[model samples]
Structures are given as C-alpha cells and as structure tokens.
Target: MSTEAEYVRIDDGVLEITLSTAAKGTSLDFAGVAAGTAALAELGADIGAVLLTGAGPNFCAGGDIRDFAAAQDRSAHLYQLADTLHIFVRALDSAPVPVVAAVHGWAAGAGMSLVCAADIAVGGPGTRLRPAYPGVGLSPDGGMSWTLPRLVGAAKAREILLTDAVLDAAEAQRLGILARLTENDEAVLDNARALARTLARGPRASYTSIRALLSRSATATLGEQLDAERDAIGAAAGSPTGREGVDAFLAKRAPDYSGLN
Candidate 1:
C-alpha cells in the first residue's frame, strides 16, 4: 500500500476506503484509481460492506490535468483509462455486499461517476457535485454517461452535462443522486458507516439477491421480474441463515449470526 494513495482497511465487517492526497483535494489520477481498485479487490473477501470517502476537505476533484497533458496520445490513453474505469465501476455496482459513498467536498467528473457507481451515496451539506467534462472540452467518460442518466433521468443528465453546473448536496439528494445529507463531512461518513454496519449484519445472501434483481429490473420485463423475485424469495427461505432467523423469531430469542459457535 503506497502512502501516496490511501490504503483500505477492513475492520470487523466494514471496509473503510479513504482517498489520500487530500491536500490536492484528493484529486484522482491513474495512480489513485489503480490503488482504489487493488484495495477493493484485496478487501472484498473479508469485508461485508465498504465505506468510500475522502480524507480531507474534498472528496475528489476529477482527474489530474497535469497527468492528462503528459500522455503521448491523449485520445488513445484516455480510452484505455476509461476501459479500466468501467471495469472498476461495474465491479463496485455488482459487488455482493453494498458500497456506500460518503461525499464531503467536491465530487466532479470521474469522482462524480464513482459516487454514482456506489449502491448508496451520502453527502455533507456543503458537498458540491458537478459534471465538469464539457468545461475542459472533453466529452464524458468513465461511466458518467451511463450512470448519470440512470440516476437523474436523461433530461436532467443532459442539462447537467451540457451546462456543467455545480450542485450542492441537498440539491443532489433531492434529485436522487444522493441518498442522504449530513451537517458535515465527518457526520456524513459516520452516518454512512453506521448504515453499512446495519446492512453488514443483515441476511447477506438475501441482500445480494435483492441487489441483483433490482439492478436487472430496468431491462427485464414485469413477468420476468416477478419470476426472479419468486426465485429469490424461495432461495432465501431455504437458506440456513434465513431458517435460523425464522426459528429465532418464533422462539423469542436472538439469532446467532457470527458465523462461529
């Protein structure tokens, strides 16, 4: 784990993934992205949930423009980078456990896409989000086009991309981009972690099944969705954990779920 990019630490059931380079507003570059991906992969097996947040005042300020300028062929380089980013985003979206983004300050460009990829997002009252691609004469990449439309609808996504306007945390929450907003960054991260802890303690298999069903609902027909739901429910009901939960309820005792005797 390089000190340049913050390393992820898994404790109990939660994976705390913090962004380094806070002094630079936690700017995202190739190094940061690589580090993040590695951390997620390393912590995936042990951690039941992930809490993504920045270290300092800002969450992330998009890409490192200096690194971009140094690329020999900007177009080709960017395309390759975009492909890597897509892999990372899709992994986050489809993770067995949930990933929560805790946004404190600026979340722009790729940073905003990262937030959108999370299963849930929380932001501080003063957090700012923006689609800043057009401002730099570059088109959107890094799953922004796919995620923004799904999050805020095509019309609003178009407006934000075309105008590149800044939106506060409350506005983002109202628009459904953020699940909740807190008074400050610390509070935002704490609340997100609390939620993650709760989710981590719940029925893990059922949670993953629900996530898969909902994620595919947009493309699946109503009948297909119904069938999927039925299948998922049946599977959950047959699991030992679910059976234990039911038995515990009937017995008026707490369910033992520590995966140990």
Candidate 2:
C-alpha cells in the first residue's frame, strides 16, 4: 500500500501530525482525510493538544496542479476533493483539544487555510505564505475565505487572496496571521511541540470549553457570546477536574490536571 499522506504519533500528551510527503508540497490527497480523521478519533479525551507540521522544507504548497490537469473532469474532481478536505477541517475545528500549527516554507492555498484554522501557530524566519489560488484561476477553499478575514481583516484578506502577494514569516506575524515567530534558526516543529507539551498538562475540560467559546465567538452576537460563556463556565465548574483546580489553587499547590504528572 502507498504511504499515507500524514502520520500521527502521540508522545506524552501531544499528538504530533506530520505531513509525510513534503516533496509533494504536503498537498493533501483525496484520501488524506481518512488517516487524519482516524488519528483524531483515536485521541482519548485525556490528550492535551494536536501539533501539525510539514515533514520537509515547505509546509504545503497546496493542491497538485499536475493532478488537476490529470483529472478528466476538473469540476467534479475539485468538488470531491473539497468534500474530503472539509472533513479534515471539521475534525480540527471540533476536536476537543487545541491545535498548534508549525508553519515553515510556503503555506500556499489550502496549506495556508490549515494555518489560519490553527488555535496557535509558530513559524520561523524562513517561513513564507502565499494564496496560490488566483494564480491558477481558482478560488479559496478549506475555510480560507472564512478564517483569513478574521485574522487579517477583510481588506487585507482580499489583498492576499486577489493579488499574488507573498507574506514572509515576520509579515505574517505582524498581520496576526502567525501567532509568533520562533527564533531565527529554531525548528518550528520543536517549538510548537514544546508549547503543546506545556498545554497538554493543562486542564482538559477547560481547554475544550475555551475552543468551543472561541469557535462560537466568530458567529455569535454579544449576548450569545455571554450566554455561551456562562453555560460553558458553569459546566466546567461542576466537572471534577475543575473542582480540583479550584481546591488546588486555594490549597496553594499546583493544579494537578486530570493526567498531569
């Protein structure tokens, strides 16, 4: 059997997902969702965070143009491709744990969308991002249109999508597209993994609730946001882990989250 497009391995509390075919620009294939979805399904509730990174120099160069030409009917093939890709996007969005992206090289097209969807992203000095869609006479997909505007505002998102502008890591950081830059020479994957490890020891339920709150905030009205926060916090307060967190704080000790050492 051919190797899967991605590989997932959990060590400690971090689920590390690496794009195995970096030479192919980490372009996600039609079947890529199966491996990724299966991996997320295997993550027990106790797991802390999911870390995503490409295997080689470039992050993901987007879909394969050659493959696009190979498809006998481009319209139907693209629809099928997007359908599979949406599953991966939904998995990331609905995952109880936070997703940390380590972006390097070129995060083009859908690859850039993956970065935008991340809860936190760490990039390096050499990292570069481009919206490679317009160049091919295609439009954005993989939730890029939705998430990019939220990060960089509507006008800037339009610029990035419409023009063939390339955003360097520093520029991406300034625009709030990248959370922050690793050291000039630091390995982005290592930095992201370290961050995820720290998060892995945090209170799981609270983190999950935090993601849910953030997700809803994108579309919720002010009153709705407040209500969601109220209900979520209330539920968390009644959880065993939440009670232990409170007790630990009052007792003047570290909060020993459910699986924390």
Candidate 3:
C-alpha cells in the first residue's frame, strides 16, 4: 500500500482507522476514502472493536473543497464523491463491533457526519462541529441527514443544519454527539483508545446484537422491537459466551472471553 493508504491497523483486537491525507486539510479525498473503505471491508471475526481518529490539525474538515472547485462537471463529480463516501460510511455502520471516535479541533461537513455516525465520540476542549454543507451551497451527505436527527432529535437537527450552527465541545456533549470530553487534544485519543480497548474485551457477539437491536428500534414498532429483543436475549443465553458469563458469576471469577473471540 502507498503511504497515503497506510491508515488502518489492528492491534490487540482493536482495528484503529486513521483518517488522514497529504492534502491541506484532514478531509478525505478519493485516496483516503478508498483506503478507509478497504480497511473496513477487511475486518475479521477476531477484531472486537474499532477506533477512528484523524491526523493533522483537525479531525476532518469535511470533503475536499479544492477537488470540488476543480471539478469540470460539478454535479456528476459530487454525485460520485458522495456515493463513494456512503460506501465507507455504510461499512462503518455495519461493522459488528462497537465504533469509537477521537474528535479534536474542527469536525466540519462530512467530519460532523462521522461524529454523528460513531457509536461513541471522545472530544477535546477545542472540539467544534459544523454542518459545513449548507455553507458550501449543498445538502448533507455521508448519512448526516439520517444520523444527525437520530443523535440530536429532528427539531434540533433541522435547526442546526438549516442555520449551519457551530457546536462547541460542551454543547455537542450535551446533545449526545460526544460521549466523552477530554481536558486536552492529547487526552482525547488516549481516552478513546482506552474505551475501545475496554469494549474489545467484552462479548463481541452481544455487542453486535445490541447494535442491530438499537438501530432497528428507530424504525420498528414497540411490539416489533420487543419481539426482536426477545429473540436476541434467547440467542445470547444459549451462546458459549453467555454460558461462560453465567458460570463466571456463579463461581465468583472473571469470564475468559479471550478464548472465544
């Protein structure tokens, strides 16, 4: 892989995906997006969690505006760009393990979308977010329209997107956008990595089921969700990990999940 593509690596059952490029901003161009897509596609059963971070002054300033400006056929160009980005976003969403993000500096445009997509986000005191699409005279993409509403509710999402409001770390945390807030930029990644490692040691299959159940609860009726939960709990109880957990509790010892996953 090229230097630009060396953005993913697995360590101790955690897949760490760094979003970076040689470009001016931390925003992903075609190369970075493609690398991310490939990395997520190659996730294996041994991988128990994912940690997403950005390199440079910002988490991600959004898509490549310079590339957008350089496009001869702007409409077609943006269409392809958004389509490719959605593929990576979908992979991130569907990954069986929990996903965490270390967000520092300005997370604008697509970067904001990513913060919304992460299952958990750790932000620093300097973290800020903006729906940069409106400022660029475009609508939201990369599932921002879908994910933002789920994170902050429809009315708040509408207001923020329509106004292109900038969200500071405290406000973002209050809105449930950032799960944790660090004292400084350096601590953001450390805390997120620690959280990812903790999650990596958990029951991976149970986490997958929990993710699916919560995602489905958004669109499913109460009755439908209840039924789904019933099935999931039943399956979990019958699994080896579940048995180990119960045995460990009864024996007053810690469960050994390392051998299972």
Best by lDDT: 3
Per-residue lDDT of model 3, residues 1-261, tens digit only? 466446777887888887755455788655666777787888887789998888788888898888899999999999998899899899998899999988989899988988899999999999999998889999999899999999999999999999999999999999999999998887898899999999999988889999999889999999999999999999989998888888999999988888676
All candidates: CA RMSD in angstroms? 2.4, 2.0, 1.4
- Between the candidate structures 2 and 3, which one is better when assessed by TM-score? 3
154 Cα displacement, candidate 1 (Å):
1.6
Stretches of candidate 1 off by over 4 Å are 1-5, 42-45, 252-255
Model 3 lowest lDDT segment of ten = 20-29
| lDDT pick, better of 1 and 2 | 2
The best-first sequence of candidates by TM-score reads: 3, 2, 1
Off by over 4 Å in 3: none
lDDT of 1 at 231: 90
Task: Give the 10-residue window scoring lowest on summed lDDT in candidate 1.
Answer: 1-10
TM-score of each: 0.90, 0.93, 0.96
lDDT of 1 by residue, 84-163 (tens): 87766766776778888888889988889888888889898788998889888888877888888989999999999899
| Residue pairs with backbone atoms closer than 3 Å in model 1 (clashes) | none
lDDT of 3 at 111: 86
lDDT of 1 at 83: 86
